[model samples]
Target: MLKPWFALCALFLTLGAIAEPSPRQMALFNNNCVQCHLRPGVGAPLVGKAQDWQTRKAQGEDALLRHVVEGLKGMPPLGYCSACSEADFRALIRFMAGMPAGTGQ
Candidate 1:
């Protein structure tokens, strides 16, 4: 009985590993952005809200990246990911923007 439960937990963990945000990216997101940005906030969910991101896509990736790097009116600069590299920032922004995980913008 315990063996089955352990196996199920292990499988779930493995599947999560293959999913979005990677460990590093996940840590970065949790630390910096989860506060105001709910998983399904009135604005958008960082995890996977395809339609919300569709509206943002029209603005272009550069605009999206710039918004994060520079900060918009309601958001603070870097959105608190100041330590994040350009590549990291790009990845994070793309992830939150509704693109599939690991899909480099």
Candidate 2:
């Protein structure tokens, strides 16, 4: 279970697919996304779990950002980070989805 997830994380890290948040982005994530993304079965995709984001990422950055801005299913608008701007949301989405730094703004 957890082993497979750990393996995937390692693989992504090796391939530079995992994105790291800046200190500012970290603040936003800590205040908002961590509450759900770091937990299991909370509806939001868990960070570092590539499979969780496979489809969403394939939808490309615009669609992902739209879902965040407009809210999708159990997710609230701006992912509850009302103080966040489009750039902030972009960074946060990349961080959680493990998208590479060069992609998606």
29-86 per-residue lDDT for model 1 (tens digits): 6678766564345454444445656777789777888888888876778888877877
Clashing pairs in 2: none
Clashing residue pair totals per candidate (backbone < 3 A)? 0, 0
lDDT by residue for model 2 (1-105), tens = 365446435544763646666678777877787777777888888777779999889998889999999999999888889889888888778877878776736
lDDT of 1 at 79: 84
Candidate 2 residue runs with Cα over 4 Å from true position? 1-17
Q: After superposing candidate 1, which stretches have Cα over 4 Å from the reference?
A: 1-19, 39-47, 101-105
- Tell me each candidate's TM-score: 0.66, 0.80
**Top-scoring candidate (TM-score):** 2
> Clash number for model 2?
0
